[model samples]
Target chain A: MERKVCAHIQCRLGPMRLGWHGTIQTVADVIKMLFKEVYAPSGADKLMFYLAPLIVLIAPFIVCALIPFGRNLVVADVSMGIPLIIAVNGFGVLGILLGGWSSNNKYSLLGALRSGAQMISYEISFTMILLFVVMISGSTNLMSITLGQEGTILDWWIFKIPVLGIVAFILFFISSTAEMNRAPFDIAEAEQELTGGYHTEYNGTPFAMFYLAEYIALVTNSALATTCFLGGFLPPCIGVAFVDNYLNMVPGVVWFFAKVYFMIWCYMMVRWTFVRPRVDQLMDFEWKFLLPVNLVLLATGAAYIVIWG
Target chain B: MSEYIILSIFLFLGAFIAAAATVTGLLLGYRTKNTANKMAPYECGMETIGNARIQFKVGYYLFALLFLVFDIEALFLFPVMMNFREIMAGHTPLSPMIVLIDLAIFIVILVSGLAYAWKKGILKWE
Candidate 1:
């Protein structure tokens, strides 16, 4: 009974009373508390793997909340919105490495290495795509870009540039998917070969948070596509002067989310419809195709901005 | 602006709380239950071990190199599509021809490299 009192204080009772005594210290009545003293690993081992990834994965989405899709639906309108996102994206890689490393498994280490290489490769191309859009719109602030396309479908970068628009969309989609470690690019989480991939060793709620972080990343990536490439929160045919002006009645936030989810559908389709390539093939695709093409695309966009804008 | 500020704060706080919980759990769960024999880097549980970080096959590196080449190529076409209108604006009557020819050249360049690699059997799975 005296030992039970010490347990109630919530102090670390390592190896004190075998396993039975750990179960008696609950918050309820002493008897019920006694029954509740089901002292498991207290889930500390699993928790050790979650904190870094949670921050890395969730921070970018938080920034996305500030990026307005339409007229008035942004969280914060920072001038360097695009740069901010890039930094956030870069930051997420650390959490991924930490998760893989802290798990302390060979497969996890390999997954981490693969993830690091893949993310860095794709991030270059992704940034180029962002720059392409920013060049066309003449602003990095998502709101300004939307406003630039406010009164016309033709004003949207997609219609304005044609081929480059398609390229940018594909680049953004592919690179972001790679960044999120979705299938076809999800070599990091290849279950058949790598066990559970990076976090295979993780158990309990820590694992759950990692799962949540992935979903959050998917949502964040989709929202970014909407804001950067698709006109955020604007109707498809709001080109007419009167219609665009009058359409202001609808809240911009709703339209922003609609565009975001449409992109999410695109992302899901990619995941569902494809088989993952071998890691080497994935790397080859990135370095040979993504890097050069994005470099050219960046140059072309820059040239166009200088010549036309 | 204030709405934006509040939202940002909320997001940061949420992330902070989640991070704190995870860290706390990790700290509590850390243990050093090492057995000296089990702790070594797996010499099949024999006396000791050789170099742990053994080199993989050269083919792996070659495959990675090829991927690097192609991924960059794909990125080049992105901006062309985005700014096609500006480039083809004044050449409207001649636009489709120009677009077709430009893309044809681009595709041909990439396709040939793919063919070269394929013919060399670099693309074959071992």
Candidate 2:
């Protein structure tokens, strides 16, 4: 009885202590510890070490600005949306390369080199899939693509083009995973091999930046996928009167995020479920399997467009 | 114009967030002088060894070269893709058959090159 009373008092006091001052103090302590880890004097080049993480963190945010969350709700509706996204994302590879090289560590350098090669190989298929989408959608603007699929579930690119659409969606999904440096394609930072890959020497806020960049890229890629293939912000309605009427009541923005998070959930599942592929297997898989399939898919998309139109 | 302005603002905001995090860490974190051993490259807790940087296989460079070729070829298809609707609508002088045949030829050449690389064992990692 006495122990139970003491426990009750302790739980109540714990909540009171954690309300305000406790929270602030904890945050301050964390900041101090983070700074200590980050500011430790190291032999690596200071400029590249710092700059690379910053660039990687920021690049994804900038790329995401061009993505349309809802109609006219985009931060920037650029004409060259697809190309711009590709260009900005390409900068992320440079940042990784620089971070690895500047660390003056062998493991970091190898990790960086692997990242460069992996990104370049996957980018070929990535671009081809985007081109295929552009061919079918008839515009490079993301907004237009979203609008094109505004009708119903059947109008979405993933279903509209039959076999080619599904193939492109799968190809895009895989390549985007590679582009974001997520597993099983994440050979660059395979911990068993490269000891944290490009960010081996990173700690503190610099490491935080790399972490931030990755999650942001995941969210942005999901949004890109939602926009390109899954009928961005379009609720499911198969030309039914009641369902269409009911679904349209919910805001497009909500639909947009719901779909985006669902895709993000899928990515999380994929990351956890798969083991990392060997580096040679990764290259061969891309060069032999993904590359050829994407080439054929692109051609099929083009032929379909010409023959049908 | 406004769109570019928004994009610039977004970029600036990202940079600002990154700088703030780093600065906060720098200001709050403790600083210590580096010792020779402390500054040395990490090697799984072993003593100093030879340089970590060594020549890698030529296969990586070869893949990079091939990537450049294929990527550029893919880019060339962009204009044709974007204008596909126009060609189909009979708005342009180009015929659908010519466009289809042209893309087919380009893809055929690209695939053949891939075949050559695969046959040469350049794609093999081992």
Candidate 3:
């Protein structure tokens, strides 16, 4: 009788059966594949190989902890928040380099080397753009920077500095996209050329670690951009009295997540829209174009702050 | 500090989550006996060739070196940037003009190095 009832229910819910049962089976298969030893590292330096995924897994979360979700809702409100973020993110490159080198595959090695070069190169412009924000806001703390633009949308850094603000935001956006190794700047993991790049040999749960790290990094980068450029957690106060009051009633965290998600959506669009550039062209774009332009913008931003203040 | 404690806790949580996933995969997944071909580094289904760690061009190394010099320079400029408002407010020892000139000079030197690299064709991709 129980078997007959089970068969009847299964037949009745046939379309819905795949939804839950299929998902569980897929999860089980993935778990089995993850545990199967595909390529075991056997050498004196085997310990370092294991450290790679662990670092990649945890570093982004550490960076995420420093980001302020709301006015006073940060996990760690360090004084040197921006610099701390830049410094901790540098460890992500270490994991990629180690994973690639230890994989004992040619494609992985090439991908790892490219990743190192790409990240270090873009990080210069990335930091320079942050410096412009620091100079304008006059504080290394992200909370103060966000608070500096609290009153109105016009007060935000993107609008506050006129042309320089917009230019800096664009430059920061580009460099950060490259820094995160998304789409156009993802020569490190170019599928046609370098296979899977640094994590080519990775599989199972270890591969998932790198994959999760990349998404987490993407979220952190977009959130930082939102906090630094857009007014962090500030609602659009259009100066209309009732509308402003209504918008303000929504919690700051909601506003923060809304803006961050919008930025993430923009990033996803860019990733899907553009084709990856050649490695040399990628380097050329940074050195010949971005670096020089950013330098000029940095000086201009400094002058703007000094002359206007 | 309490802030550092929070950061450490967050870090620990991230690690714990990652470890749990990996351990669960290991414990629940079926283990198959390793074979020579199955364990080899993948090369598009071809037999493994010579080691992948062969020497490439030195141009990449040169670019990284240039990046290092400028990155350090940017770090040194952070203090000047952070203090711009204070200098302008007349709270600092240095005047705005003096600070601006100091920054201009530092930038000029860095720019000249970049120019040198360009002139030497080190920045050239082809």
lDDT of 1: 0.64
Q: Number of the top candidate by TM-score?
A: 3
- For candidate 2, the C-alpha RMSD (Å) to the true structure equals 6.4
Please state the CAPRI-style docking class of candidate 2: medium
- Give the TM-score ranking, best first: 3, 2, 1
Writing each residue's lDDT as its tens digit, candidate 3 over B6-67 gives 98898888878777766666665566767677667778999888776678778879977997
Q: Identify the superior model by TM-score, candidate 1 or candidate 2.
A: 2
Model 2 ranges off by over 4 Å: A1-33, A40-42
lDDT of 1 by residue, B54-117 (tens): 4444554555565556445545554454445555554345464566477668767876776687
Candidate 3: stretches off by over 4 Å: A1-45
Error of 2 at A114 (Å): 1.0
Give stretches of model 1 more than 4 Å off.
Answer: A1-50, A238-249, B1-11, B20-126
TM-score of chain A of each: 0.80, 0.88, 0.88
Q: What is the number of residue pairs that collide in model 2? A: 1
> Which number leads on DockQ?
2
Interface RMSD of each: 8.1, 2.2, 2.4
